[model samples]
Target: MQCISANAIFGYKKSAKDIHKLEIDDETAFIVEMIFDYALTGKNSIQIAKMLNEQQIKTPAWYKNKCDRRSYEVDSKTIWTSAKVMKIIRDQRYAGDMVGNVRATTKVAKNDNIRVDRKEWIIVENTHKGIVSKEIFRKVNEEIMPIKERSNVAVGESRRQGFCYCAYCGRLLQKENNPVNPYLFCVRQKYDVKNGCDEMKIMTIPLQATLSAMVVKYVSSLIELQTFVKRSKMKIFQNHKSAMTGDEIEKEILKLKQSTISLNQRYHEGRFTKEAYILQKDKIRIQIEELEDKKLQILNGIGDKEAQKEWEKELEEKIEKFKDRISFTESELAEVISRVDVYSQTEIRVKWRFMDFTAKATDYLVRAQKIAC
Candidate 1:
């Protein structure tokens, strides 16, 4: 059984012998069941949290620390938040499933734990006795949760559904369709006005214009860069060909394959530890795969003028659509921009997608300039 931590999760007690063998804590299991029942009655996470707080129910963090002295200390005054309630409701473990690889730490951002996509999550069903039945959990999550989320906005009303956020509280800004002026405001401010930001609101017209202008600028810049590269006769794809010949790539791949065999031999001879062998093998595998892709690119004539022209034409069309107005679709906007932080109409920050392309383009241009010199 894979080691699991049930300390923070309510309604589950971890076994001393094997943490994976989780037992139901009857006391907290009742709360878990009640939360699901509340959801079934059309109560949202916020309402459920409010209800829990009203009842003076101890939070999972508080309960964990009280039960175990060694457990991480939480404030005695810790109260149930909507986020915490939603987390518990969404947890598959409460429905008798063991989930793994739900989150990962990247080498670039070691301290930050990012959620892995649900499709990538490894789940084993009937792992332990459930606090709530799987059917009830699924209905609450898939049916009830989505309905509660969309209960605020009318169908086809949210243009900037997932992208826009409140700069003050960092919560998603909800759209308000006022006859005089439609605007986005921090929804939290509506509930907790004292704690929430009053200044976190922006008119939709200006916000859309800002986003449209940003998209236009981004596409325009890319188009200009492509034109500059073409005019300079420093083909971006051609540079890759010049960097490494097809024969050279094949040779490198062969060397990597040979290294892999040598690594296996060392592992069998007990020279390389299992951890070191696996790590080195993975690195070699990645290098070989990259070399193979380069070889394929060269073979497929990716440096041809037709391919370059097609790529430029695509960018030109994208810019043309957003040139006149904010005609860019959600999918198109999502392709270029990851998020939009709306501080106000005058101060909107956009986190763009395809940042790697910009970095690569700059590197290519610098190398091209050096070669020209």
Candidate 2:
């Protein structure tokens, strides 16, 4: 994994045989955390980027692309931009995982790197400790999802239209001059969605209404999910209650005890001197005593129910803070939603942020894609 990209939190180990683990860069990690936190406050990528640049913070790309690490040019060229901020949030690496072979190999040199469908790509999670929690990562990306541009959108077009897509084509919908399929519709041109999709259009007005309501509902449900997950994590840890498995320590104990038994049998058969036998028995018994002590230490650490509960509380509080920042502001309705798909004037598919969190929360309350037409 470290071999693929130089942008890893931690670079590859000196040992070639070692797994490429994420090494946290203390300097950049704080920067990343700040960016994610600011983003939750209804700031767009451009706004967040501007703030970071004004604070004289070095961009992540600055650490990567600059040939001379020492040069300090005080110009816009040496600062964070919207594109950089959006790229960091969109990356799966900040969530502490890397995906490989996501694009099919192509013959054309420039147009060759088309992304494969997500289902077809390989995903390996929890490979290393993430700088941001999975929930935080998901939350940030949920905010800044790109919307397609339109040529003839009305002045009063719904801000929610930025979150809409074409159900048939999976492209971000574009508002146009067409009266019949007015508002967000797909002109599938990107290879990712263009092929295998028939032309599709959705009426803009109703889609905006449906999505706005859904956004409010999902954010409300997140409050309960945060509370439930806190208790559940603690209960899970307490139930297991062991740092090392019982089988591991027991196996070691059994192995050492059998060595003493073998020594006794050998002594009876006159295979060694009494002096030799005594020394060997003493060594085996010492090992047994050490293992017993280690077993007790491990058990005591895991059995600290109070400690585990306290830790869970701290985690829950952090999650609450993160969740509190997530909201659908009137100015940035586009930030919270990824895309809505248009099926008809009365029906559309809304893909909200926090897929797993939102999916579970809105399971009975909302439909996924197919809604009333």
Candidate 3:
């Protein structure tokens, strides 16, 4: 088959004679063959991955990076994973087939490539020399794929589908649909015990209760902060207005205008020079402009207070809606909570989306109180 020069597939490299043609990479091909052999021996993908990791074999990603330094960059700690092993076992290229349109990207999500249905894939058989024989590939697929599919059947949608994660292994926890009580546990613990992940199983009901309480507490705090900020801003504005009365500002402007009149009369009477009269009149003009600007600012502060009242009302209404919520839907949870890390049945840490905002608000409140004092 033809290999793209941009990034050649694993276990194959571009031919020196023809840049478009692919040649078997002996080192990576042996690894691909070993994966198929393991599948033929009734070993599951997880088991095969564990065996490879124990042997400290470099993964396909590492091989790809070795062949072309720019293709894939992998750390020294990179090890074989079940997903990587399964991908090698299912690759048609190793069976001498040319497969196309196996995955496609859409206009709406250009970066997200989704697998096309098997029936829609364009696969041509016996296109090139194979690392594994066609018969062996067929047998491995027929024997191992069905069992994997059966084990992965979904029972129902989980309420905490994408939010729950294992605190130890940092893997997404899978939901188990137990009849009495549904729970979430780390799937890695089931497959690989030595993977440094503990057995994590937390019931969905108690988790939901914890999340609900956290959300209620968060909403109550936000409402209080909003009220405090509104009142504090109004109080600051009132104190500022009391410090400088509008009547006092008007009197200052009147005095400045009278001084300008006196300066002009002195210049006409030849008591002061033209330049001195002009400079003195300009100074008085500036003082009157400053007092006028102050009056305008005070008037605008009244308008700002009215607008603040409306904004506070709208914010309070939204916060109040969540303060009394007994439970959160999956979509609602996704909007406010970024993730929930489950350490155990009783210990979980929730990261809320508004944490940064809350911290900034608290800082502003402290500064505002300091200024008010």
Candidate 4:
């Protein structure tokens, strides 16, 4: 027998007030209140389920089916199933976070539907609250979400997976929703109303692979760019330093100050009107202030020598540790690499941090080839 009352879920009890006060979305609050109500009434889930059935209250599935104009054929016996009750109590959707399908299609397919990979799930935070503590709900979800196998193959290729766009037009050209059969589609088809992508029809997987491979190769070219930047950064810094001459800046400052003094004298003698004098003085004052700030910065030094040295030491340590390692985890990869852009066919373009260039050029190339034909 439960000790809690149903109304305790609503109108706020001392124990649940802290959680209730939290600004959660309406959907989440509704779930939380429902759970609290069930707990407070001292009734087990079955008793509550029976009560709901007696009242002919709608279930989430029933409501959704009704909204879609679909027929409800399920037995009342299964409507109050403990699994369904537990699922509602534990759902994270009430916690104000949006969790959604990462790879599954809206259209039912010929073959068995497989679960989407966790990496594929598009999640956004601050969605809602739960019936229980967030920590408890998270633990329950961990038990529920599909665990990935080390060597598990994804059932279907994602629609926009590993895709990049044209910087000029933002048109994404690639094959999407590839399973046993795939289609190539232009991003402009979805976004633009007029004169969308003026391009070729959906090429087969093999052509996409080839194009993707070329794109990857194109991005790998940036390795040379990384090398070039590494070699030239010191030279660039030296050139910038040389351009700032203290004596020339000081001369300009003195000239501006002299002009300001002359302007003030003309105003005191009533040779200039008040508004004209003020406008001229304001412009000169701004320039003088800028020159002063530059002079101060030069005196204090333009760069952080200690911080720079610390970073250099940290880089050396990381390089030493990773020198013998064959590869990096995703986090390490993210630290060095920026974005990967995909182009039409099998092209993979990559951008890296200033120091070095590294690309998963081989994997993408192989995938594209496998996809072709």
Candidate 5:
């Protein structure tokens, strides 16, 4: 007989430097061990709950909380209230199996207790390392079977705290409300909390608006750059890749007219399906319209080349206008760039937006260069 410490498996803190130490399979085994330890400790759920809380251990809810900027807290009530623990014990994931579909329900109207039968179970086993010994696991399931109940909805504070950070101080913007106004203050200067900055609390709305305008401006510049590239490619297609020009349009029109006459003869001889004949006939009609349009454009080009050039020039002017307005958004600037740490008022260093945009732009230019050649 061998003994195992529960902490050795689940308690291994995953860090970047030691990420390769654990395999995914081993992690699942560890989770099962954690579950097993909780169930077999011979304590009722509430007693186990208190021990976890007293130790300041993180619960699943606290671990999953995205707004945890400063602290992680787990209430004992959450541990006693969760249905997931019971569900985990019943789950076959811990049993080293892919077992599923243990019950089927009847569709009876107006019955408060609709009938469900356990005969339809499809059990698959030996899928992974067992979380618990089969005998102990099975016994736990049987013991808890009589007390199974539906879960309760968890209640807690929904208002997000410490979400907004100060752009000036790089500290969490503490929330405050007044009858006249509401604001976020840098905890450092206001109350000397950890990582607090000495700057006065900043007003939220105008700062947010200024940042938003800046981001809008920046996006507009990028879009204008993309549009410039599009226009350049379109010019190449218009001048070099045109399918039907002056000489070509004349030849295409003659061919289309001949094809239309031949198709009409086949229709009259009942040599085509009605649908096929109509479809082919309509295609020829569209080809005729397209050929005519091309012919007219080519003929008019002799006199209207200057006007078309002016229209193209006007489009380029619009693209230029869009490039002039790119600005930084407050949220994006603060979050993405972090606060600019100023050691001196006169000396400043600017950090641009993420390298992602620059890399994308470089890749685009490389592809565009290839296309141009």
Candidate 6:
């Protein structure tokens, strides 16, 4: 039987140079482990850091700060900051990857850390044993980031965030609310635009509601199409029956015409009198007219089969686009839709994940209001 400490960091010890190595000290390893767990369990960085402080868990900065040597109250500020907790959680080191020079100093040789461009940073993957799975770490970051960003974001689902893009410049839109209403502004303009974004800002509620209405119509059209197809299939049998009857009538008319010719030939050959031949011809003419009338009665049922096939094919293709489509809620619009291009009130184009439901992008008058936001 062998025993091992839960805090063991596989290969090295507590030191500055050793920080980049696969090894970590017992205390730091435990802290990293706890932060990872807390993040997975929905604890934001602030909450995790506060919990750690309350538990009196010595931070990794204890050595640098000389907390024990100094006469400090050991409050939340002295112990750990939310940024420290987030940094630990964001570390690629736990995922068996190495990242270097994440922060650089200002040009004048100050110890202060400044954010460096991601392109300038060094990143190496699969360097050592990982404490947390990369998938878990990825999920934690994804979940935590949205939580942190939610205060400003109007509304979004976990799957729907970051799918939005500006209609004009194609920059992503960020959710925001004014005292009047919630809207999405072009992130380019919101953060950094050389001059300004020429794109129109989208009001979230009206835009979402309009999208949902368009999807509803799309879905309704599909249902109606399916019903029409069923009725059309039923009419197929009736059409075949009518066609057969028309063919039979045509054959009968041809036979009667032949008989009438034979009768005319008999009269010319003097095999029958003029009156008899005339009467016989008249009978055949009447029979032919009757058959033609019967054929005409069923003519409407006959249709262009090739044109019908094409129409059905087109409907089938449209139906295929919405196979997974369902009755959508307002929020679920984000699930099916990838993005929306607001050309104007009437010309809003919704690019769906499956396909564009608003194919025409018309019919904005869902209410008394002339158009959607």
The candidate maximizing lDDT is 3
Give one digit per residue, the lDDT tens place, for model 3 in 233-298: 767656554455667888889988888888888899999988888888888888898788767655
Query: Please, what are the lDDT tens digits per residue for candidate 6 over residues 79-174?
Result: 455656766666666787766666676666666566665578787787666777898888887765556532332211221254556556564566
For TM-score, the strongest prediction is 3
Candidate 3, residue 178: lDDT: 94
Scored by lDDT, model 3 comes in at 0.72
Q: What tens digits encode model 2's per-residue C-alpha lDDT throughout 1-373? A: 5425433432212224444555666756888888888877767666777677567787654664453433554333345655556666666777878677666756756654555655686777877667789998776665344442111222222322456655554545667756765565554422123243334655655555666677666665666665665565456456545444646877999999998999999999999899999999999999888777666654444444475456446545534544544343534556556666676556766665445543432331222111110
Candidate 2 global lDDT: 0.58
lDDT of 6: 0.59
Q: Against the unseen true structure, what C-alpha lDDT does each candidate score?
A: 0.71, 0.58, 0.72, 0.48, 0.49, 0.59
Give the C-alpha miss distance for residue 117 in model 6, angstroms. 2.5
> Which residue ranges in model 5 land beyond 4 Å of their true spot?
1-156, 159-163, 167-171, 188-196, 235-362
**Candidate 2 local lDDT, residue 68:** 49
- lDDT (C-alpha) at residue 332 in model 3: 78
Q: Which stretches of candidate 1 lie over 4 Å from their true place?
A: 1-10, 13-23, 26-161, 176-182, 190-198, 234-326
Q: 3 or 6: which has the higher TM-score?
A: 3
Steric clashes per prediction: 0, 1, 0, 32, 13, 0
* Higher-lDDT candidate of 1 and 3: 3
Count of backbone collisions within predicted model 3: 0
Residue 356 in candidate 2 has what lDDT? 53
Q: Which ten-residue region of model 5 has the weakest summed lDDT?
A: 1-10
